[model samples]
Target chain A: MLKIDNLSVKYQDGNQVLRGLSLSIENGETVGLIGANGAGKSTLLMTLVGILLPLEGTIEIDGLLQDKKNLRELRERIGVVFQNPDDQLFMSSVYDDIAFGLRNYGMSEENIKHKIDYIMKELGVEKLQNMSSHKLSGGEKRIIAIATILVMEPSVIVFDEPSSFLDPKTRRRLIHLLRNVPMTKLIATHDLDMALELCDRVIVLKDGQVYAQGNAKDILTNQKLLEEAGLELPFCLQRIEL
Target chain B: MSEIKKSINRISNLEELTYRDTVIHRLPPVIKLLMTVIFLVTVISFGSEQVSGLFPFLLYPVLLMTVAEIPMRPLLTRLLIALPFTLFAGLSNMFFSKEAAMMLGGIIITKGMLVFVSILIKTILSVMSVLILVSTTSMNDLLYAMLYLHIPTIIVLQIMMTFRYLSVLAGEISVMYHAYILRAPREKGIKLIDMGPFLGQLIIRSFDRADRIYHAMKCRGFEGGVIFSEHKKVRTTHWLGLMIVSVVLLILRFVNLSELIGQLVIG
Candidate 1:
């Protein structure tokens, strides 16, 4: 339901980050974006979210927000989980962090509390409601970050390195949590296994261009293409026949 | 820098140690902030020469600070840090005093002390009020309170964005500083002149970082202000409690019993 066409971005100093990169996703589809460090994955995501205006190109969400005039309406419709929970969460308590979005939307107090409870329960993070961000474990912090966006109940969810620092078990749990989510998801990560296991489609981003895009099975089985794009194959995917 | 980090850790823990189960923490930050303003306005409304009148007014902020469990020493230390500024401004009165007031035991005092004390008390009270506000409320909560109070959207966005960018800038600068420290071995610290390039680079990178952050927000469909679906409306009793505290403070400010006692004790 989201379409980005020939998007480009440059810093004020005129350092180009994203060079005419185009990407799209359907409703309820989990699309994996793989790139090396500084490949402009984050830049592309930010451009789509309206956090950064593109230097060129058009972004359209079908049957969704069409223009900048209804930005508040549009923002409320998309959820972004930032790479660092520390930066995303600026609240004193976990409950407050999750409730921050609701407060921004000016939701009624009862509804705010209800949404927080429901999201926390779904994430199995009910016990972290009163805990400070300083006291949380890295895994718990990741979950809390997810709750911050999930509580908003946006139509599209964009996650930037959701499993970056998580441990294996925590990463698995997180993968499960992400799998259960029913929104259009655009995940940018270097984790090939996660991309293979959790995404229906995989797109390789190399040097600010889309190098390859196809079904998960087709993309995961191509060893040479994965290596050329600086990505390794998942062992499980490698064991399967093409 | 390490010392600062250690002290931050120490102070945050110490602050956590002396928690009081008071109603103040439960009050909405905007209401508490307004009450502090009202208390200060009442203090300023009284004649500056009326030292006794201002003495009792001290109890409002003092009692609140004490009962609210705000660490008095730190609050006072912060106040003392800014004390010299007020003192310098007040020192001007020493040179030009046209009026002298009657003093006890054939001693005479100028209107300067009266004005000076008013300024001093006013400064202490206001600083304490601010300390207590931050102590009781989180910075993020205060920002949210400001938003809910109908503060202009752009200002709120600026505040939030500034906070987000501060650490990003700090981290970049800190890394540069660390690299310099490692390479340049010296018994003495790095000179201010040595920091010039680092500072300049940081400034350049920070603006670029802000641009990136803006794009990040936009990609998530953030057009202007970030919005969410859940918010809890504050309860009525919370409002009632705030009004009660403010009204009581208002009543106490007018009745100049403290001033009477100070005058009687001196006379």
Candidate 2:
């Protein structure tokens, strides 16, 4: 399980962003992280990745605590896919980017190639292996980004706005892809419909604290709670009500 | 703004050229890097009056361009961009070295003119070899070669990151300039007074982007000073190629092949 206990973070300007936010994700579970513009979703993701060390909180994954000493090992257990695929796909080619983490751990070339080939095949992006990551289309880039993370084989994966730049066809394709992933997933997104389809449970954030948490159906359908959190019901849910 | 866009395209075009597969392109990067260094050092060692000997070195870039399918036009065009500097250095030789060197086809060629020609030849040979190296080798392979040479990994990573994001930086400049123009239509160029804020904004934007990129890299288990490119093993053919090329270049550097060929033709 991935756990964040009473996590609080402050920006350089001294504004508190994530105020005592705590959540836990069980292994093989899909949890939705929904929030308004300044509800600290991005901040929480940054904290999870160890980019911004919390002023006071503890991040635990599996049997390890996130700290200066265990950071490198902890990064292997929890993978983060940032908001921009461009940022994550920094290496020259898709193949290189996918092999980056494994290479960092000093894996042999033969083994790296084996792992990368398998992951690319799994993502159905084998043809894109040699292509420049910068030249890929939005959907293709998104898939490659996912491949980069999945090749690491993390115990838990966190995604920030996975469906943002994709078209409808691509978004549906992504939804399908996310459904097939077996590891624990925390998807922070405003695409409530996708959250409803992919997540078994949902955590709503308001003022950098957990506003509500429960079954996806119960929490997503609770109209008043969503309103207080500065959110609305998924369009699909509204259509069914009509 | 258009210049920045053109620059972005040029960077992409140069990168695209490295994807071509050829025997020269397939050679391990370290051997190629060594051969280039040998070529450059030999070219630089030629004395000012040895213009005739320098003619044989042209064969290297010509053969490379033909075999690798690289166009000469773009390389020469890029050469033109550096012409002013080389041209200045060569022309100054005309003023200092005043001696009658030889007579060519009923005209006297001064030593200064000969020196000028030699300097120009040296510049062309040096620049062409480097450009061909870049056009044929992928950036990652070249960086790996640098690592093989024992360059510090941090420096290599810095170079790789800079080369990778140059176009992105150019794109950012274009967008920011466009937005600035839209906001200040009446101003012609940026006013001196607003320059501080304008440049300050660019710095801030770059910092934010860099911070995000660093975070992304860290998330991928990138500890500082670690290079991910695999070290390619050099094959026998690669070693033989490097040996033969170095010997030929050294021979050309020492022997006046131009004079020997002329003698053979006369006999």
Candidate 3:
């Protein structure tokens, strides 16, 4: 379980990106964080991962309060897929990229090999293991990026924006991937359809504040509240025309 | 995401250089580095009077750079920057040497030219060898080679860290330069005074970025010492390539083919 309390972040420019936001995710739960541009979604994720420091707040992952000293272990336990896949995929080969995190954690060579192969196979991306990252298509790049973090075997997975730039087919595949991926997930995205399809619960952020939170269907189908928060209900939320 | 894309572009560009299936490109960097040192030593040991002898030694670096596909024009341009300083020293010799002490066309021409040539060749070979090494091997591999060559771990780590931050710093500098271009009038070249402030801002931002990177690396469990997870076996072809190059360079140091060709051309 991950719990964030009264979290706030402000840049040197004095722009507050996250405003006293509080949220929680239970074990094995899939939570979607919805917000428009500049709504502090990415900042919130970064703060949770310890990439960005919060001005005021407490983050507890699995009953242990988060602090700078134990940040390495915390980050190890929480696999974060950044909004941009390219920033994190820094190795020459796909195999090397996937094994990067594991190696950083000091995993044995044999175990690194076993885990990398196993994760790639599990993700249905074994064929791409030798392919250069630059050559991969957009959808393939996204999948490979996720695989890089997933191979680290974190207990919690946080995706900054998984559905961006993907075609409908790839988006559907990603939703399916997320649904089947074991471990707790906190996904921050603007795609309401993805949220409705994959998240068990939803948290709405507006101007860096949590505007609403509830079961996925209930929050997603509420046209009035979503509209006020600069969000629109997913097409799936609409009743049949007939 | 755009930032990430830029980094991916940087990484891809780095890998493309090493894709050649050549024996020289595959040699362990330490061996290649040692050989380059030897070449430099031989080139430097030539007597100041023997300009003809040094010409043969010139073939060593020239062939390497040509085979390595390093464009000579730019390399020469960089080497030429040092010529002005050498000319300053050579000019003093020309003006201040006593008539009895200086041989006609011997002391001023031979000794001065040789010293200048020696420095120029050393500078070019050093830079060219580094360029060749980096072009043919990944930065991580080069770092490993440095470690194997018994370089200080702290220095290697510093180099690796500096490299990691270089891209970040480059991006920041590019952004600042772009902003300056956008706001400043094109007719007046960037004001000389503005450069100071611009660079000052860049250094401050770079330090902040470095701090962030350090934290990020720490969070990702980066220990002080670098770890190469997999060990690759050294192949025989890598050794053979080194031996061949070394032999050819050694053979050329004594040859007067350049003088013979010059005479033939003159005839």
Candidate 4:
């Protein structure tokens, strides 16, 4: 389980982004975090991964509290795919980027190679193993970024803007892949259709606070709430009676 | 825009050449690195007027390029980028030391000109050797060799990260430049007064990107140091290759093969 209690984040510039927000995500659940620009969606995800320390709150991943002493342990159980694939895929080659986490955790070479190959094959990116990360197409890079995170086998995976720059075909493929992954996922995205299709629950954030939380169908179809939260109802459900 | 694109292409081209399958490329990075160091040391140890002694050192890069199937054009182009500084240093010798050192037919070769030629030769030999090493050895193997040689992990990590981020920084700058140009199309170049904020924005963006990269790395379990999982053992052939290259370089350093050949042909 992942839990955030009264989380408040203050940036170095004295901007308090997240304000007393508390939420809990159960294991094996796919939750969609929908919010407008600067709605603290990215900040929340960053805080979850311990990249941004909250001013007053506690974040626990799989029962391990987020702290300097428990950072390694907490990070080991959670993985984050940043909004920009370029930031996530830093190593020269795709194979090295995927192997980075395994090596850091001191996995044997043989096992690391095996895991990387398996993950790449699973993601249908086996041919990109030797290709430079920066040379890959945007879609290919997004897949490789996910592959890098998935290979680590983190229990809880967080994605910020998972479908931001993908084409229709690639977006469909990514949605399919995300649906099949059997782990806890918190996806922050602007693609309402994707959030509606993949997530079982939705948490709407308005100005760094949870405006509403309920079933995916309920929140996605609520045009009034979504409009107030700086979002809109999904096109498919725009005409459907709620 | 084209300049940025060309630079990004250069970075990729250098990396792509290292992936070629060849005998030189197959040589272990440690052995190749050691040979490069020895070649550079031998070339620079010659007297400033010993241009003939440095001629044999050319064979190292020539043999490697041919055997490794590397195109000489790119290497030469890169060498040109490093020549201006050396040329200035060589020009000073020409101006300051004008005493006659040798006779070519009826014309006198001044000591300064001879030394200048030697400097140019030394520069070519040293730069080409280093370029050949990089072209043939992948960055991964190079870092591993550095670690094997007991180089500080921090320095190796710096090199690795800098190389990895070069293209990214280039791309970011290209975007910023394009944005500036779009808003000010009539301007030929950024004004001197505007350069301060223009560069300041680039630096700020780069630092923000670096912070995010560090966070991403930390999320993937990067804890202060990098661990390479692949370990390659030195083979017997690598040792033999290293020995042969070292012996040939040492002989060239001490013996003037050019002078010997000239004497045999003309005396």
In terms of TM-score, the best-performing candidate is: 4
DockQ winner, 1 or 4? 4
Model 2 lDDT per residue over B35-105, tens place: 99999999999998889999999999999999999987778887888778988998998888878999989
- What does DockQ give for each predicted structure? 0.22, 0.61, 0.31, 0.67
lDDT of 2: 0.87
What's the DockQ of model 4? Answer: 0.67
Better structure of 1 and 4 per lDDT? 4
For every candidate, C-alpha RMSD to the true structure in Å = 5.7, 2.7, 6.5, 2.6
Ranking by lDDT: 4, 2, 3, 1
The positional error of residue A42 in candidate 2, measured at the CA in angstroms, is 1.2
Clashing residue pairs found in predicted model 3: none
Model 1 lDDT per residue over A166-231, tens place = 999999999999999999898998887888899999888888888899997788779898899887
Highest DockQ, which number? 4
**What share of the reference contacts survives in each candidate?**
0.24, 0.67, 0.31, 0.76
Residue B14 of model 4 has an lDDT of 80
TM-score of chain A of each: 0.93, 0.97, 0.96, 0.96
lDDT (C-alpha, whole model) for all candidates: 0.73, 0.87, 0.74, 0.89
Docking class of 3: acceptable
lDDT of 2 at B1: 36
TM-score of each: 0.73, 0.91, 0.70, 0.93
Task: Estimate, for each residue in A48-142, the C-alpha lDDT of model 2 and write its tens digit.
Answer: 87888899989999979889888889899989988889888877678888888888777888989999989888888899887777778999999
